[model samples]
Target: MLGDELIALLGDRIPDDHARQWLADRWVPRFYATRPGGARVVDLGCGIGESLDLFRAHDPAVRWVGVDLEDSPEVRERTRGDAEFLTFDGAAIPLPDASVDLVYSKQVFEHVERPRPLLADVARVLRPGGWFCGSLSQMEPYHSLSVGGYTPSGWTTVVEETGLRVVELRPGIDAAALLVRRLLGMPAFADRWFAGTSPLHRALRRHPRLRGGGPRVHNAARLMVSGQFAFLARRPED
Candidate 1:
C-alpha cells in the first residue's frame, strides 16, 4: 500500500476496469497456463472488496472469497451481492486446508507484521499445484504501516524461505516510460501499471518473445527500475 495522501490523489485514476484487465491480462495467463479452469480464488486482505469485480463478467466458474481483519461498511457495501467476505483474526486464515487453488493480493504483504505465519497459512490452504500470485513493494515509500523495504532478491527470498517455490519472478515495470509519465505530471499514468493501457506497456505484451504473459511487463535486464516485485509461485505436489 502507498501513503494515504498519495492514494487519495491517485486511487480513482486507477480505472475500475483496470482490475479485471490486470487479472485477465497478467495473472491468469501465466499462473493458470498449467491448470486452466474456474479456480477457487481467495483475495487475502480484501479491503473494500472492489477487487471482487476483477474477474471477467462471464466467468462465473471462478469462485471468490475475500478475508480481511475489518469488515467495514465500505467492504460490506461493495461485496453485497458478490463473493463471500470473511473477517479474520489478523494472522490465521479460517478456510479449510487445501481448499483454494489460487491466493491473490496486491500491496497487502507490507502491512503484515509477521509474514512467516501468513505465508505458512497461504502454503497450507493452497491445493497442490495451486499458486500465490501478486505484487509487493520493491521501491515504495513505506506506507500501509509497513515494516520495511526489500530488494528484488530479498523479497523473493522471503517467499521461498516460506516453502513455496518461485516459478516466475520479474521486474514489474518499464522504467523509461514510467519516468516519462511522471515527468509529465500524469501521475494518473501510475495507476495503469501492469494493467497495460499505455502504449509502451501494451507493446510489451505483443512481443513475440513475451507472448502469453501480461502487458507492459518486463522481467529482463530492464527490471532494475521497477517499483514493485511481481511473481507467480506454486505449492508443490508430492
Candidate 2:
C-alpha cells in the first residue's frame, strides 16, 4: 500500500464536496483577503495544490507556493503552470525565515506524528503578523494516503504552544454524517441531500455552496450531531 494506492485510499475516504467548499468559501477567502499585492503565500502539505488553486483564483497577483510529499500525477497535472509546487518534508519546509506573508494548510495537521517541529518551522518561516490559516479533521476516520495521521486539539495546541495567536476557529461539516455515509456506502448522498435539485447546481457544477449564513447554521447543526472540527490561526506581530 504505497504511492497511488495510498493517495486513492485517503482521497476516497474524504468527502470531496465538503473539502472543496471549505477551500473555496472558508479557507481561500479568509487568507486571501489579508494578503497585500505580491504577497507570498505557502500552502503547506498542499496535497495536489487544490488549496493553492483556490488562492490563485482569489488573487492571481499573489505569489503562491505549494509543498507536499506525494506529488501525484493528477496533482501535478492540475497545478501545472499555475503556481510553484515543490516536493518536500512537511515538518521541515524549504524556505527562509519570515519569507512569506501567509502559510495555509487544509486538513494536514491531524496526520502529523510530531507537530512541534512543524509548528516551529511555520513560526520560523512566517514574518511577524503573518497568518497561518488552515483546517484539520479532529473527529474523522483513520485513513491515510499520504504519510500522516489525525489528532483532535493538536492543531490548536501546537499553534498556541509555538507562539501563534488563535484568530478564529470554525466548525466544519459533520464527520459523523460522513462516517454514516461511509458506513452505508453512500458518501455522496449527504451532498445531494443538502444541495437538493436546483438550477444552481448546473451553474456551479461540482463546487459546493460557498456562501449563505443559513447553510452554515444548518451545517453546524449537522456537525454538532456528526462531530467534526476546523479552525484558523495567525502569527502575532512582535
- Which candidate should be chosen as best, given lDDT against the real structure? 1
lDDT tens per residue, model 2, 1-238: 1112322322222222332223213656756566566789888877666765566677878788988776544455653656787776658899999998988877776666667898889988999988887666656666564344333234455677888866544444445555665577766556653223222222233334323324333223232332344455667888
Model 1, C-alpha of 212: deviation from truth (Å): 23
TM-score of 1: 0.69
TM-score of each model, paired residue for residue: 0.69, 0.69
Model 2: residues with Cα > 4 Å off, grouped in runs: 1-25, 70-81, 145-154, 192-227
Cα displacement (angstroms), candidate 1, residue 132, comes to: 0.7
Query: Candidate 2: which pairs clash?
Result: 6-145, 110-149, 110-150, 111-149
lDDT of 1 by residue, 78-178 (tens): 53656688888767989999999989877677677777789889988999878888777655554546665555555556777867886655455544554
- Reference-based lDDT, each prediction: 0.62, 0.59
